[model samples]
Target: MLIVGLTGNIGSGKSSVARLLKEMGARVIDTDQVAREVVAPGTPGLQQIIDHFGTGVLNADGALDRPKMAQIVFNDTNALKRLNSIVHPAIRAQLLKAIADYRDNPDAPLMVIEAPLLIETQLFKLVDQVWMVTVDAKTQIQRVIKRDAVTAEQVSSRLAAQMPQEDKLPYAQRVIDNSGTPEATLQQVRQIWSDAIDRSQAQAE
Candidate 1:
C-alpha cells in the first residue's frame, strides 16, 4: 500500500480532503479517531492521563473530557507538551498496527493517515508522502470559529499552539489549497487521488 500522511493546520479542511480520499476508495485511518480510542474508558492511556492530570479531566462516565483538557493544555506550553508525551506514543502504536493490518491487503492500494499533528508528532516519517491541506489565515480563522463555535481568540490561540503552515510546507510532497470553493478543493483531491493510485500500482509491480 502507498501510505500517505494527510495533515494541515486546524480549520485547513484536512477532514474534507480525507473524506474525498475515502470516497475515492482509499482507506483512511484518522489519527484523531485513533486518539479517542486509545484514551477511551478502561484503557491504560486514560488511566495514565488521569494519573497525570487527575480525575477532573474525566467525565461522569469516566471518559476523557476533551474540552476541559484542551482548555488546560492549549494555554500552557508545558501542559501541552506533557499531554503529547503521553498520547503520541500510544497513538503511534495504534497507527503502526493499523498500517500493518492493511499493508498486504490487495484491496487497499492506498491508505491515508489523517492527522493534525502528523508533522509535529513526527508521524510523517512513517508515510510514503505527505499531503498538506492549506487555506489563508483569515479563512482558516473564520472556518474554525464557525465550525468550533469559539471566539477568534480561542481559535487563534489553538492555531498558535500548532506548528506554523510555512514550517510544515517544506515537508509536504503535495499541497492542497482549500481556500477556494468546495468544487475547487475536490478537484485538487481528485488529482492527488489519481496520482496516488498510479504510484501504488507502480510500487506493486
Candidate 2:
C-alpha cells in the first residue's frame, strides 16, 4: 500500500481532508483517535499521565480532562514536551500495529495516517509521501475560534504551541491548499487521488 502521512497546523481542516481521502478509497488511521484510545480509562498511558500530572488532570467521570490538560501544556513548553513524551510512544506503537494489519489485508488499496505532528514527531519517515493541508493564519484563527468556541487569545496560544505552517510547508511532498472554497479544495484532493493511483501502478511495474 502507498501510505500517505497527512498533517497540518491547528484549524487547517486536516480532518476534512482525511475524510475526503477516505471517500477516494483510502483507509485512514487518525492518530488523534488512537491517542485517545491509548489513554482511555484503565490504560497504562492514563496511569502514567496521572502519576506525572496528578489526579487533577482527570475529569469527575474519571476520564482525561482534555481542556485542562491543554491549558497546562500550551502554557508551558516543558509540560507540553512531557505530555508528548507520555503519549507519543503509545500512539506510535498503535499506529504501527494498524499499518501492519492493513499491509496484511489484500483489499487495503491505500493507507493514510492523519497526524497533526507528523513532522515534529518524525513520522513522515514511515510514509511514502507527506500531504499537508494549509490556510492563511487569519482563516486558521477564525475557524478555530468558531469550532472550539475559545477566545482568540486561547486559540493563538494553541497555534503557537505547534510548528508554524510556513516551516511545515517545505516538509510536505504535496500540499492541499484549503484556503479557498470547498469546491476548490475538493478539486485538489481529486488530483492527489489520481496522482496516487498512478504512483501505485508504477510501483507495481
Candidate 3:
C-alpha cells in the first residue's frame, strides 16, 4: 500500500483533508486519536500523566481534562515538551502497529497517517510520500479561534509550537492548498487521489 504522511500546523484543515482521503478509500491512522487512547482513564499512560501533572488534569469522571491540560501546556513550553515526551512514544508505537496492519491488508487502497507533528517527530520518514495541507496565516488564525473557542494569543502559542508552514512546505512531495472553499479543496484532493492511483498502477507494472 502507498503510505501518505499528512501533516500541517494547527488550523491547517488537516482533518478535512483526511476526511476526503477516507471518502476516497484511504485508511487513515490519526495520531491525535491514538494519543487520546494512550491516556484513557484506566491506562498506565494516564497514571504517569497524573503522577507528573497531578489529579488536576483529570475530570470528575476520571477522564483527562483535555481543555485544562491544553491551557497548562499552551503557555508553558517546558510543560508542553514534557507532555510530548510522555505521549509521543506511545503514539508512535501504536501508529506503527496500525500502519503494519494496514500494510498487511490487501484491500487498503492507501494508508494516510494524519499527524500534526509529523515533521517535528520525523514520522514522515515512515511514509512513501508526504502531503502537506496549508492555509494563509489569517485563515489559520480565524479557523483556530472559531474551532477552539480560544483567544488569538492561545492559538498563536499553539501554532508556534509546531513547524512553520513555510518550513514544512519544502518537505512535502505534494501540497494541498486549503485556504479556499471546501469544494475547491475537495477538487484538489480528488486530483491527488487520481495521481496516487496512477503511481500505484505504474509501480505494479
Candidate 4:
C-alpha cells in the first residue's frame, strides 16, 4: 500500500483533507483520535497516565480531565513531553497495526496517516510520501482561534511549539495548498493522490 503521511499546522485543514481522501478510497488513520481511544476509561493507557499525572487530572467518573492536562502542558514544556512520552508510542503501535491490516488486503491501494506531529515526531520516515498542508500564518491563526475557541496569544503559543511551514517544506515530498477553498483543496489532493499512488505502484513492482 502507498502510505501517505498527511500533516499540517493546528488548523490548516488536515482532517478535512483526510476526510476527502477517505471519500476517494484511501484508508485514513488519525493519530489524535487513536490516542484518545487508547486512553479511554478502562484502558492501560488511561491507567498509566493516571499513575503519572494523578487523579487531579481525572474526572469523577474516571475519564481524563483534558482541560486540566491541557493547561498543564501548555505552560510547562516538560509536562507536554511527559504526556507525549506516555501517549505517542501507544498511538504509533495502533497506527502500525492499522497500516499492516490494511496492506494485507490485496485490494488496499493507498492509505493515509493523518497526524499533526508527523514531521515534528519524525513519522515521515514510515510513509511513502509526506504531504504538508499549508496556509498563511494569518489564516492559520484565524482558523486555529475559531477551532480551538482560544485567544490569539494561546494560538500563537501553541503554533510556536512546532516547526514552521518553511521548515516542513524541506521534508515534504508533496505540498497541498489549503489556503484556498475546501473544494479547491480537495481537487488538488485528489490529483496529487492519483499521481502519488501510481508512482508507488510502479516502485513496488
Scored by TM-score, the top model is 1
For candidate 2, the per-residue lDDT at 168 reads: 91
Candidate 3, run of 10 with poorest lDDT: 100-109
lDDT accuracy of residue 194 in candidate 2: 92
Q: State TM-scores per candidate.
A: 0.93, 0.92, 0.90, 0.92
lDDT (C-alpha, whole model) for all candidates? 0.91, 0.91, 0.90, 0.86
lDDT of 1 by residue, 43-83 (tens): 98999999999999999988999999998996798998888
Weakest ten-residue segment in model 4 by summed lDDT:
100-109
Instruction: Mark the 10 consecutive residues where model 1 has the least summed lDDT.
Output: 100-109
Output the lDDT of residue 16, model 2.
98
Which residue pairs clash in candidate 3? none
**Cα lDDT of model 1 overall?**
0.91
Q: Write the per-residue lDDT of candidate 4 for residues 1-205, one digit (tens) a residue.
A: 7888999888888899988888888888888899789889998888888888888999888899888889889788898888889888888888878777877873556788999889877788778789889898888889988987999998988888778878888888888999888888988988997897788779889
Model 1 regions more than 4 Å off = none
Clashes of each: 0, 0, 0, 0
Cα deviation in Å at residue 199, candidate 1? 2.1
Instruction: Name the lDDT value of residue 122 in candidate 2.
Output: 89
- Among residues 3 or more apart in sequence or in different chains, the pairs in candidate 1 whose N, CA or C atoms overlap within 3 Å are none
